[model samples]
Target: MGQIERLADLVVRAGVNVQPGQGVVVDSDTAHLEIARAVVEAAYRAGAGWVEVIFTDGPIQRSAVDHATVEELSASRPWALARIAEWRAAGVASIGLVGDPDPHLFDGADPARVAARRHDEVRARRDAMFAGMRWSLVAAPNPGWAKQIFGEPDVDRLWAAVSTAMRLDSADPVAEWQARTATLAARAKQLDALELTAVHYLGEGTDLAVGLPPNARWTGGGLIDHDGIPYLPNLPTEEVFTSPDRRRADGTIRVTRPMVIAGQLITGLRVTFKGGRITEVWADEGGDVIRAQIDADEGARFLGEVSLVDRDSRIAKAGIVFHNTLYDENAGCHVAWGQSFPWSVEGGLAMTPEQRVDLGLNQSGVHTDVVIGGDGITVTGTGPRGTVDIIRDDEWVL
Candidate 1:
């Protein structure tokens, strides 16, 4: 097999753990057809009963999302999510490839229509595969993405970076990851034992207080369900994270790095949180969208996640910002302000939104991850006794 084919096989058989005879779903944009084809072949090699490819075209989505009618937004597709759920329930495997070349393709689009269509899709799959789903989110570096990250389209370099980050260069990446997971799990257990009060974040243009829920649990590495079925979420993950209390955070958080928000790249984005809700949002570019989002709805202003990254993060070390989630999110400590992942906690999806909210789970159809770390960043945790440093200079200080 060629390099891409081998990578796809590793992702399907090792990362997602495709079971024999189980159906497989490959989701990607048309720009990623090369990787998608490799995925199909890998799925078949893994003994998948059936393999389905869903190619999403960003330009087409941009047109509809930016110019579609209100009715069009209201009648947005629902069957797609339903089909995914059906496959999940049947123990099918799913591998998603996400990396946008133009992050801001929908920057000036109608936010209401976006939210409307978004809610419909979220509502559809709200209960899909609460358990028994083998899925992994991976990346396929395209020319567009390469151009975004490297100033010019250099796919070879991008692929090299991705492969290195994913440890595909290793002689036995699976075994390497096994050791890494144990280390991360041990760290999570240590942090969880502390029962932290709040995490203090500090950096240039940043000072934020991140509060933890009473039952907040630190999570790292691959996820294993109650049934002991392990699955990776992000193929090149190196962060430990937890869901945060959406109603108790306070202070200012400036986006230390550029991010692709709602399809447009937002730079110099900054926000002030009061009483756990974003009270002010500012950006050098794409500020209007941030304002629109903060004004979108009540839940939009609160936080959903707080993740920590080490200095060893591949994206950060590479010194290239891709402005894509599949890579950027792996670079540093970041947070999401909407739509908490049910998989973030034990029994996350089994509970309804209302039930989840009662347990302090932030629920929304939207999940926006924004980086908040920089060279001078320092993250300290406080508990009943005192404070302890967690990260400094974008490196883990603990």
Candidate 2:
């Protein structure tokens, strides 16, 4: 089989684990039509009852942002929400092909509108996340993404890097993932054993304490759906993460690497927090976009996730910044300020919003991750017994 077809098969069989009689949703950009089509075909081959493709056109989105009223843009298209709701009720699987071809398509538009989000849509999607949706996100290489990485459209080079990151370079990529995910799962168990009350990140201008409640569960590798079906929610996964108490983060953190938000690259970002709420945020580039994202909602200013990735990550080893969160966030330890994964907390999935808040879980319409740990960093866990190191000098020690 061709590489794309092989990749599609992996996405269908392992990514979301399309089951017999299960309907599937494939989300893609216009630039990734081929990959989406391949995934749809693969899903059908995997005995999916039906496969649907949802396409997004970047240029048209740019036009809307440039001319559409904020109210018009904020509706998030009720028809789209209806589709998601329909899929949600039917228990459909979702697969997304990312790696936008034009990261700059929204540049120069009103950053406010560019960052404007529909809370209704965000809440609906979050409701289906993991258990309800059984989703996976994988990258699709294209000329624009390649150009951003290498200053030229070298799709072959981009594909080579993606293949390596995704472990497709191995003779048995699926087997390799099984082995690697086992290791990550083992590490997660160790962290869980620690019964950590909080995790401390110390480095350069960073000395942040992210609170991990007693019921917080650290999860890595693949997620189990409602039916106990295992599915990889993200390809090239490397971080063991948990939903932290959104009310406990404190200190300053210097973003260690660049991150992309709303098709804009943010660099040299530094943020300050007090009692878990973001008090200050600044980035050398794309500052407006990042700031706007922080202002998306009240919950957007608090911590949702704290993750640790060792130096052994293939994405970091590749020595190339994919400029995509799917790859870059795994390059090292990262933190997200927005909606926390419900399953990351024990019983969180079934908790009402009020109950979640009582447990310090964050609920928002936003979830943006920024890398904060890499070289010269120290990660430690502190609990009732004492404190122990988890990662040092980019190596996992727990």
Candidate 3:
């Protein structure tokens, strides 16, 4: 079989682990229809009872962002949220194919409007689904995205890098992924055992500290649903992450990778945190967008997650910036603002939003990750045993 066919199989059998008689929902943009179709076929081949595709038009979304009024931007489509809730209630499996064909589609749009346009109600429903349902996120490379990264429409070259990052080059990709997941799980176990009070990051242009909740659990690779079905949240994932106390972050850090948030490429980004809130934001470009996003809600300015990745990551070793968070965030250590993962803490999934907030878990409609790991970076963990190296020179030391 060809690589695309193989990828579909891997996604169906390994990523979401589709079960017999289960419905599958595939979400993708027009640029990724080819892969989305393949995923549908693969799901049916895996005995899926039914498969549905939801297509999103980039140009239409860009138009909305450019001209929509504040009321329209903030309005939640109840029908849309209801559809997702119905799927979740039916135990449906979901597959997301993401790769922006035009990463800068809304580059000149109003930053504040763009930030306010996110569907807050839909976002909350999605978060609830994540706590209970099975889903997978994977990439679908296209000519436009390839051009953005390599300065040329080299689709084949881009596919090659993606295949490597996804471990599709392995003789038995399924077995390879299983082994890789085990390794990440072991690393998470080690971090959990540390019972670290805080994590300190030091590097050029970066000096920050993040406090962890006592119940936080570092997790990555695959997660099992309530019914014991294992699902990989992000394909080509390389980081082990935990939810940090929303009220304990301090100091400043620089973004090591360009982040494409809300259709804007933000570079040279530096953010200052005081008591876990984003107190200052600076960027060579797109700072307005970052600032606007941070002001989205009361919780948007606080830290939600902190993840660690080593230089040995497949995405980092590939040495290509994909301009997508699912790929870039895995390439290095990163931190996010808004909406902490419930699965990252003990009994988190069952806790009420107010209870979670009281325990220092951030709550907002936005969750944005900014990478901050590279050469010269060092991370140390502090606990009852005192400080110990967690990462040195962009590699894991623990």
Write candidate 2's Cα lDDT for 1-398 as tens digits: 76788789888887898999999988899999888889988999999999888898889888889998777777767887897788888999989899979888887889899998778887888787744688899989999999989999999999899888988877877788888889999998888887899999998878998888657899988888777888898987999999999999999999988767777778899999999999997878898897888888889999999999989999989988888889999898999999887777788888888888888989889988888878888999998779999999989988
Error of 1 at 377 (Å): 1.3
What ranges in model 1 sit over 4 Å off?
74-78, 107-116, 294-297, 343-352
Distance from true location, Cα of 373 in model 3, Å:
0.4
Per-residue accuracy of model 3 over 188-251 as CA lDDT, tens digit each: 9998888888999999999999999877888967898898877787887788899999999999
Tell me the spans in candidate 2 whose CA falls farther than 4 Å from its real position.
none
Candidate models: Cα lDDT each: 0.76, 0.87, 0.87
RMSD of each: 2.3, 1.3, 1.3
| Alpha carbon lDDT at 248, candidate 1 | 78
What tens-digit string does per-residue lDDT give for candidate 1 at 235-340? 7777788888788789998887787665777888899999888888888888776676655556778888898887777668877776777677778888889766
Cα miss at 202, model 2 (Å)? 1.4
Give candidate 3's root-mean-square deviation (CA, Å): 1.3
